[model samples]
Target: MVENPLETETLARLYLAQGHPEKALPIFEKLLSREPDRLSIRESLARCRDEVSRAGREAAVNEKKRLRILERMLARLTGSTPPEEEIPAAPAIQPPRPGAVERRLAVLKQMLQRLERSR
Candidate 1:
């Protein structure tokens, strides 16, 4: 029962193409460990790590923006002053994917709905 390196590489690339770099990273790491001299695998591993790092940063930024929006919405509901800083312009957001903004907006809407129901 031998695992084919080419098959493993194909699986890793599939994960990357599907936008699951986190899943792909460990596979690349394992592949690199077994064949450290493969330049192409090394490069792919580096790229996977970069994508994972970028995704984490983007998530953090989006979480902050979501919290800010929620805080303002709550303040308005409670008749308190909203935060002094305005929500940044829409163009300021640099999402990693085309559907990221839509997904965030959907989550925010659900949060707002829950808040309203609690009142």
Candidate 2:
């Protein structure tokens, strides 16, 4: 059965709204391929691609942050300091609270020590 273009476009938009651009990407691509002159479809395709790219960059940044946190925790456990270059600088717009890093490190160290004792 032939699918209605309007229905397909609506489905694609729903996927985009639900934060699943990956799913919407193919649908938009299909719509655009069938209706290359349709400006709305073309715009939706561009938006979907941009969303996918943005999500990828965000995931990479989050992964880096998680790795840095883990490295810091490991360094604390081993009584060694992580290299200065490995530490990320605080965002300029929102300065970190004084002693915040130290407090967090201390709490992490206590938790690690307790975990070691439990083992």
Candidate 3:
């Protein structure tokens, strides 16, 4: 059985289009090895390598952020302060509507008065 090079190339391009550069990288590598002079193959291989590198850097940043959060939680449990470093800023919180707390308290007071009258 013979493997078609054109089919392999198409499969590699498909993987690249689907954002699976890691999967496409080795396929492009193999294709380049078979035909080293093909400029398209060389360009695809380089693109795959760049995508893989960018992914690695992003993963590292995310891992660091996760570790920092874990460390902060551990510090709170142990009654110690975490060292000040590059902590990612928390998401912005929206303030409650005007008079929201007063309205809730008024409702609770009305309920209490009704209960008292019934007793």
Candidate 4:
């Protein structure tokens, strides 16, 4: 039955003050959506998002670096190739006829000239 918006804002602020930023974020965002011009509420919400994103990004970077360093150290200590997918050997190639390669090259050059003239 509270008629005052400030009272609701105060309660949301209390939640934030208690280190329950996640709990407070939705309330603040809802109120801000109802009154989008409230700069103070918008700023608080932005701060919360920025902190969360920075923490997430830093954790991702640390994890990536840890894996990279471990891979390098493992390669160095073993002095052996790390487990890798085997590349299937290509089938042996027969030498092409002299005119065959020349014809392909000529066709490619003609295509290039046509592309250049179009541009």
Clashes per model (N, Cα, C within 3 A): 0, 0, 0, 0
**Better structure of 3 and 4 per TM-score:** 3
Q: What is candidate 1's lDDT per residue for 1-119, written digit by digit as tens? A: 67666659889999999999998998898899889999999999999999999999999999988998999999999999998886457676664798888999999999999999999
Q: Tell how far residue 49 is off in model 3, in angstroms.
A: 0.3
lDDT of 2 by residue, 29-89 (tens): 8888889999999999999999999999999999988888888889989999874555567
Q: Rank the candidates by lDDT, best first.
A: 1, 3, 2, 4
| Inter-residue clash pairs, candidate 1 | none
Candidate 3 ranges with C-alpha deviation above 4 Å: 1-7, 87-119
lDDT of 4 by residue, 1-119 (tens): 44456546778778777866666777778778778999998988887666567767988989977786787789879896654543669999999987999999999999999999999
What is residue 33's positional error in candidate 4, in angstroms?
A: 1.9
TM-score, cand. 2: 0.64
The reply for model 4, stretches above 4 Å from the true place, is 1-24, 73-119
**What TM-score would each prediction reach against the true structure?**
0.66, 0.64, 0.65, 0.41
List pairs with backbone clashes in candidate 3. Answer: none
lDDT of 1 at 6: 62
Name the regions of candidate 2 deviating beyond 4 angstroms. 1-7, 85-119
lDDT of each residue in 31-96, candidate 3, tens digit only:
898899999999999999999999999999999889988999999999999867875699999888
Q: Give the clash total for candidate 2.
A: 0
